[model samples]
Target: MGNQVNLEEEAVGRRGREVQRDGEKRGLEGPKVLREECPSSRDLLNSLRQVEKMLAVHEASYQQGLRSLRKKISALHNSTMAIFRIGKNASCPKPEPPGHGRRLGRVFGIGHEVHFLCKPTYELIGPRTRVCLESLKWSGQQPMCRRVNGTSNSLASFSPAAPSSSSSSTSSFPVSAALSASSSTPASSSASSPFTLSSSSPTSSSPSSSVRPSHCTHFLGSTRCTCDVGFTISGRDNNICTDIDECLLFPLGQPGRLCVHQCVNTPGSFHCFCPAGYDLARDGRSCTDIDECENRMHNCTVDQVCVNTYGSFQCVTVECPQMKNATYIKTSSMRCERNPCMLGDKACTQAPNSISFHFLSVVSNMSAPRVLFRVSAARVLGDTLRFGLAGGRGRGHFSVQRSGRQTGTLLLVTPIKGPATLEAEVEMSELERNALLGRYLTKVTLFVSLHEF
Candidate 1:
């Protein structure tokens, strides 16, 4: 019975071994026949699986290295194509000289210690003299050598690089195609065609007609164009621009329609232009002068009249613009009236029953064609009606005195500066009288009529 029992135990052991083998093969069974099998067998099987995963990880890393190498090769190939491949009809090219073959007396010029080996200047043993490129020593592969026909300063030719492929001649882009890009532009163009680069200057054979002015000189601050403002180039050539004057060539500043108007054109600068019938004032602007004689300058010609008009000198037998209350004063005094008080708005102060005046302290504007001054309370002191307002308290009186010259007629009332009666008096020189008298007066007219005078 014991033998029978031993046989049964042996049969069970063999069956367990077979089940474990089949499990391992199916990847489901292993040293453990089932999930509930011995734990030791499960642990051993897991350890073996870990070893397989580590091996796979190492192999995948190696494959990645191969992919990187492939990328590097691709980059190098593209670089080689860019640098070495020449396109047909290349725009600009570097010159390349032909190569000469190795001579019988050549040298292996490569490697470092050449001079120590070969003498500085060694001639070969041949009948035609030649310098040994080989250093003094008997070592090294190739040595530089040359025939004795040339002098020492003659350039030594180095090994030439490989020859590049040549291109055919008929590869130029069409000229019409080059010109098509900027048809609207009337200016010279260099856009379409391949323009040659010269270290010095452009060659004569090139189309200079299509080039811009090489150098432009400035006068004052403006550039001088060959053509004037209204004209343009008349021919295909660059230097053919023309000038045109629509106005008759009237001398500038003279009475005219166009040529040489009131403005002066220097080499570069230009003056403001004024039209005829308008007098050009000092600021070169148009202003009207009243015809005081017509309305009257003095308001009376034979008596005391002179008139002013815009740009023109005219005689008006009519009423004056300021006649109603125009206080007669010396024509020379007009400038003083512009800045009536040297102190401007601060010239006076207001008081309840009356107005007070501030002495201008140190006054200015005294140097004028006609100096005008008003004594604050001169007339208030009952000085001979020297100044009288519409409502006469005789509070003020103004003085118009000559400090400089006046070109035309002048009439003014004497100021109370002295005991001179402050009465309206006509002051005229012999020449002034004749000029004022229309019968003997010459009508001097304005050159430019930007202003009426």
Candidate 2:
């Protein structure tokens, strides 16, 4: 009985070895061959199990043979399981490519990677590359290619908000470590092989575009999407938020606008901007006129007076005129009063008795035929005054017209582009029936600014 059991055990062991070798060879033939041959290998193992059960009836007599047969069966079962595992891990499911982007590497075998690239003017929103894992899953999240918003580049005035805590630090994936720990097969070992999808021909498939951002927070049994400080919720979905164009919402010319001069729209907020001669106020939503004269920001010389305007400043120089028989006294920085002279002095009566200086600042290329200055007699009792433009560098651009019996007006006929200094003198003669009694001259200085307020 012992010899019979030993013979049966040797035959079974020999058959098991042959089946193991065939299974090993078939497993090398790829997953398809292993799948087709796996059933036969299982049937052979069942036959060996039956033989071991039949010998178990004479357990004490054929203990060695039974033990040997069981060992062979165990070895064969382990080999089959290993082969099955290899076949199962042969490949992973192919992942979908991102929209407006192209993917490389068609082979979906374990440890294999696929690279993603965005089209021109589009941005990649997720991982650039993904690797296949032993669990038959792709590493990291699926990537996407989104359209690049023109607001990012065109709106250079936009100030980006600080990064959130979750996005402040980047975290790296442990794909390589995971790959190393997974069981290695013939396909997995050569995972570095060149198996790339065509990147030259980009896919033209269109995907659903997101209109708003997806940033949500959960609290008190409720979930809400929150945008940045300057952003607000958009649409009825309540899952996303979009940027608020404050500049468009509150325009410059509108009554309740944010800025006094100009409003610049950012991604999430808006910025107030003042014109050339103004500054942004402390409130950040309004603009304040810059006091160039008070701040000493004017370029006036030491001999010139700095005068502030609506949005600019002007520098003017006033000096008492020197004439024969005309002694002038300084009444103010811009006024010159004639000293009392003898009534018989003809030169003093002929020349101007009082001369004053006036300064004005205007923007470049102002409208034509604007009344710039008015000259009126302090007191008049049926007295006539003749007003005319005296000889000066800026006489050609101005004209003096008699407005009333004792009043005259200075008209700017031509607009001047600046930064330039225009000097014009207005001579007012006190007359009684065409006879000149006394004369008064006024020097007018116009400071044309380079910028239009």
Candidate 3:
């Protein structure tokens, strides 16, 4: 029995080797072979069961790992796609074509701005700066710069006239004498008649043609009556004429007004007149505002602003903060608040030089709340200052006006939810001969806390 078992075991080993070789040729992992054979048939059956159990456990672990790897790869691919989408959406639009005016800036991307400049003799008709919006479009239409019309009295030189009434005659010359006169007479003598003549000679000397009425004239051998000024020929035979009212024909139209503010029709012509605060334009038919401010004709004080109205102007006083020992005064260039600090006095160091603002609650629209503040310094030469927000939480919300060199107004806007804090910073620098003298810094903090009562 022992010999028989050994022979069987050997046979089994040989068969296992053949199977492993076949699996290797096919690029597959082959099953492991047992080094020792079972002593009896019952032992062999038990060993086979254990080996099957181990193989099942390892297969389950491999499937779980494969599923985990697939999930990670899918997540990475989705992240990459999301990044590409954002890069594509952030692209800017193309630049517009050049117009009558010159553009100051070249960058035309989102949130960028461009300024327009007209020539010396031209005037701009729209916003000075156009900004690119988030919608991939410009905020407003491009402006146009057109030459100013200085010679307002030269309208007659460009005005259109009737095709038949270019030249005027004295109306005293007889049509028959013009026809009977020989070629020796000057062409100018017969051409004086308002009616255009095709030929100087009469076609026929019949009595009916020569006996025309006094009011009628002969042209092209045909008798036609002449119309008075402001009248035109209207009858079918072109003999009878009717009165014409020039005021009824586009008297109020732009560039072709026959009257300024009011029109009066006369028997042979029309007259134009203007209303109060307006004077007749150079064309003598339109009304233009009489600029009291431009002509130095205003009665406003030096500290008042001459704001031009429709037909007149208003004098408005400059607004100043209500503070102790501070008075508003008007200089040659601008209106400013005068304090001891403005005189370069050392007493300014003891006075309160900082201002504080508090906001306990905000409106419902917190997405973009606009807050304004003003900062003023002594009018000193070569002294400049810059204002900005320093905190990372609300840095995007602050914007300062760049126009005022010494005194300026700062604006803050931001979108917030719940409670937030803002920190503002102001930097001051002094310079002489374009060389820096000293630098100073100031800070202010604002706490925004809202309660849902």
Candidate 4:
């Protein structure tokens, strides 16, 4: 009975062991079964890795293709640039030279050069030479020929033809004798030269005898020639004589000018003229200012006063304002005095104590904000004083500003057209602690002339 019981226990232990083994096998198989139901993790990971590798390859290929395209574009740009360069190197358009000028060098290509020249009387204004560049353009600006500003000093010298025996005495005529006659002659007369042969000479009988004359001296089969006082020989041809333009040669502001204001050039001489409001003095080159006011040359009316200025004259007038209960007295030519006001007369008391007239000449359209006139009190005993523009036709163009304790300035605030009159009433008020003392009115008349100087 004991042996049987021990065998039974061993059997029971073996059965329990077998049951535990079966449970462990089921646990392992459970995961395998679930993995089959879904997708395998290892297969999924391998597929994702392959797809990533394919995408990397595609990206690399795309980048390589983009690089290839960029290279082709660069090559095309280079080819186009080369073609443009070739076209530009072929030729350049011909340039036109200025009037009275000529250009040298016929070829117009890259790195080529050209030169310009002007006539004898003209002057070259711009670059003398220019070069064609690779960019198909000239290197410098096109040259121009401009007429010279002053007269030329070049002389024309020629040998006089052999004089006949009858006229040999007059061949060496003295220039001094002709100078006196030329001075007395008018400038508008034709040019007369002492070197010219008279019609009575034997050589004058020929129809082709040259009438042009020059100062000449025969010495040992060689002749020396010269030009007269007011003439010079041409640079190109020594046989030709040209008049000297004294006006252009000696312009204003330079020494040796013919006139103080204006110089008019003629065939062989020049004339001096003075500007308006001036008289030509005894000395032909100088000028004297004309007193239009004294001479009564102005067109001023009886009410206007004639004022003289440099190179011009002006007419200006100022009248006292008409007001009720006020009486004005003419103190002087340019001043007026008011009678003392009555104690009960408010209108007379409020009016200006004195009114004065002033005339001034100004250039047309002068710079604005310029101080035109100044008003000042010789003595200041008031507590306060003020200055202002009262009323006039020119009030809009003017302003009054205080310059000092007892001085005020009338300033031109705006520019105005001239050949017209500008009238302004400037009033000065004296106050003792804000109480009105007296007001003086000044009637300023400005004569704006059309001339600048």
- For TM-score, the strongest prediction is 4
- Estimate the TM-score of every prediction: 0.17, 0.41, 0.28, 0.45
Between candidates 1 and 4, the lDDT winner? 4
Can you write out model 1's per-residue Cα lDDT over 120-150, one digit (the tens) per residue? 1232211211222223223423333333222
Question: What's the residue-level lDDT of 45 in candidate 4?
Answer: 100
State model 3's lDDT: 0.48
Considering summed lDDT, which 10 consecutive residues are worst modelled in model 4?
A: 179-188
Which candidate leads the pack in lDDT? 4
lDDT of 4 by residue, 1-453 (tens): 999999999999999999999999999999999988898789899999999999999999999999999999999999888867687456678988778877655688887766665664454556656788766789888877665433322111222245323212122222111111111100111122223211111212221122223333344444344433344544232333345567787798776656778887654446788867778888666777677888888899988878886567777665565778998877776877789888889888888889888777776678898998999987776899899999888788999999999999999999877777888989999998888888998888887865443
- TM-score rank, highest first? 4, 2, 3, 1
The deviation in Å at residue 102 for candidate 2 is: 43
Each candidate's lDDT (Cα)? Answer: 0.29, 0.64, 0.48, 0.65
Residue 152 in candidate 3, Cα distance off native in Å: 45
Q: Candidate 2 residues 1-453, lDDT tens each?
A: 999999999999999999999999878888876678667767999999999988877786688788899999999999888757787358778888788776655678887877665565455556656888877788999887665553443221122222112311112222211110100000011112122111111111212111234333322333344332334555444434345566676676667766667776654446667777777777665556677999999999988889887577767677887877888988998899898878788777777878888888787788999999999888753367678998667788899998887788999999898777888899988777777777888888888876554
Candidate 2 structure, TM-score to reference: 0.41
Model 3 residue runs over 4 Å out of place are 1-215, 219-221, 236-239, 251-255, 291-310, 324-334, 341-453
